[model samples]
Target: MLLTDDIIESSCRHNMDFDLKKTLEALLLSTAEPILLKDVVKVFARYHQELSEAQEAIKGEEDEDDIAIEIPSLVTQAQIREALEQLTEEAQAQNRAYRVVEGPNGYQMVTAPQFAEFVRLLRGAPRPMKLSPAALETLSIVAYRQPVTRAEMEAIRGVSVDSALHKLIELELVIVTGRAELPGRPIQYGTTDKFLEFTGIKELDELPASDVLSNHQIDEWMRRSEEEPEEISDEDVGLSKEPKPDELALDEKFVEVDWQRENVESDAAPEPESNENTPL
Candidate 1:
């Protein structure tokens, strides 16, 4: 009898695992976009919790005693990954048009590359839309310094970016995330999922090194400075000037001063005792 019970318990556990796999497969197949593993796990957990609650409710109705119902084992990340892998293999073995693909964003069901031509044919010819140089520059700035504002973009580009920003928004490459907490509360912009899809990249980190642009800008500035040296008048001798290379290097290592903290402290500081008699 003990051995028979053990077999029954094992069969139940196997069925539970199979049901979890089916639920996960349904979720992945139904979603239009890639679903994160954490989200999938949350869904599974909530479902199990509800099931347990229902089971307990039925037990209460059947018996006057408030007995607890046994909850099945919670699905683990390992199980989800394993199920995804199995599904991918099954699709490949059957030569299915769509297959599960893992990318930096998440796991998505994408059409096989070999079936691209057929998909395009069914969708009809695509429209030709190319990004302009200004648009590209603005996009790069938004992609790198994400949550940047239009004013910031203009500052970096050294030109009016109203047109470029409009174009980017129309193309669905960039989106206004929120407003900066500055004086004007300017709208902040950031790249979108479509941007990733267009670039064929999964994550922002996949973009080229950011320091490359900084270095190029520094070189260009040096070149322009050499081409046109600023005139120093005799009266400007005592005035502050750009720091020397050694001083600049030292400044680089120094911690950034918090202007806001400094302002707050200055405001909070007690005013010096007024010398009314001596004051004019």
Candidate 2:
């Protein structure tokens, strides 16, 4: 029979079995929000006096135990389980939802996975955003340094880039798939397919090698930078448009310096003291 207000109210008012009344009340209560069998059982024990007598009869003991009766004996633990099962089946039949599953280490009431399509229809789904540049950079670093925290990235980049990281989330370039095992359990960021597209690379291996700038190349760049004056125009700067194969030959002949050794020597050099005692 269809569940209408008059039908439910009439059943409640006339010749109502305590079990049926409790079930009706449970259905009404659950209408306010998602309710579980355990919750309904608690209410039946508290409010239904006839259920208490029925339970005492089922117990088959005449002791004045003074125990607060909850579910009637007719609705034994096994019966309660069965009733809950029936309620769940009925809910399914009516295109309603009922289920229990583990969530974050505890059980929760959730719509059956099959009814997910219905819930999705009622509530519009969330769409992912595009990743931004800084998000991409953060994602790249995190990808290379799996399980790295935000602190590590900030230390390397020498800047606090919280905002950029948030933008990356908006773009879906970076996602917090898991947490680091550190004390605070900080979130770890990682790249998505969009990162590869943005970089125009098939994989992380396709990225340009850091070895492109050798010590000799660094020295050449420094020398060229120092000797070459700020440009005016090609004509005014005395720059030749003609190819200089000979310049390449000269460049090939130059011996490369060990920048590591030079770096130490440069650091060891003493600083010039202020000229406080200089002769007038």
Candidate 3:
């Protein structure tokens, strides 16, 4: 007989625990990519399905050994979050070489930074290449003010982000989210799950909002830009309209004003041996 899988209240208290943390640890170990809380619940659901089948198979039969497994009937995302936190703490307490981290997508187990050298040696991988200062600055703008356009990033960075933005896209840290509903319908860029992974955060909201570039501040900046946009000129972008000295016309008094009638010593013959030999 299956008991009700509802929440129970205890007057005194019941010492209860679930294998969720250990189950999550196993899932994280086997999973190649970060596993979402929903996916984790699906795994448990599948187990319940199998258990139901087993119970049906042994109905009204003389079974000495009955299949008995206990777990929460309904697992919520909060429960999964709590379990992952426990796993993380357990790893820390045991001084484990690996730890569980919640990435943008979900949860994953990664090698600890202290053991990074050993892991790198095991994989024979080189040290990771770092983003250039220009790229970092460009990425910061895109991350904070995501669904932004190239022009918007340039407006914030005060320079063209073509090269830096291209590099970020190549690195899969940024992606084209969609097109803006503006005059040109510029393509909007946003940080990717991989970007969150790089930054060691669960989401964009987890990014530490700095005093200089908080979300509200960025929003205000955007609003002001639409209301009172600054005029950008070629000079602002390191361009000049001044002509070179060669482009200036020479004065006719000092310089000869011969146009297409300059002294032409006749066309070169197919065989100009006389000119080649120097006429006597």
Judged by lDDT, which candidate is best? 1
Question: What are the TM-scores, per candidate, against the unseen true structure?
Answer: 0.51, 0.27, 0.65
Backbone clash tally (model 2): 5
Alpha carbon lDDT at 197, candidate 3: 80
Looking at model 1, report the run of 10 residues with the lowest lDDT sum: 60-69
Can you give the lDDT of residue 242 in candidate 1? Answer: 66
- Candidate ordering by TM-score (highest first): 3, 1, 2
Identify the superior model by TM-score, candidate 2 or candidate 3. Answer: 3
Per-residue lDDT tens digits of candidate 1, residues 119-157?
Answer: 878889684478999999989989888788887788778
- Judging by TM-score against the true structure, name the best candidate: 3
Candidate 2, position 177, lDDT: 70
> Candidate 3: what lDDT?
0.76
Residue 27 lDDT, candidate 1, scale 0-100: 87
- lDDT of candidate model 1 versus the reference: 0.77
RMSD of every prediction: 20.9, 19.5, 14.9
- Model 1 clash count equals 0
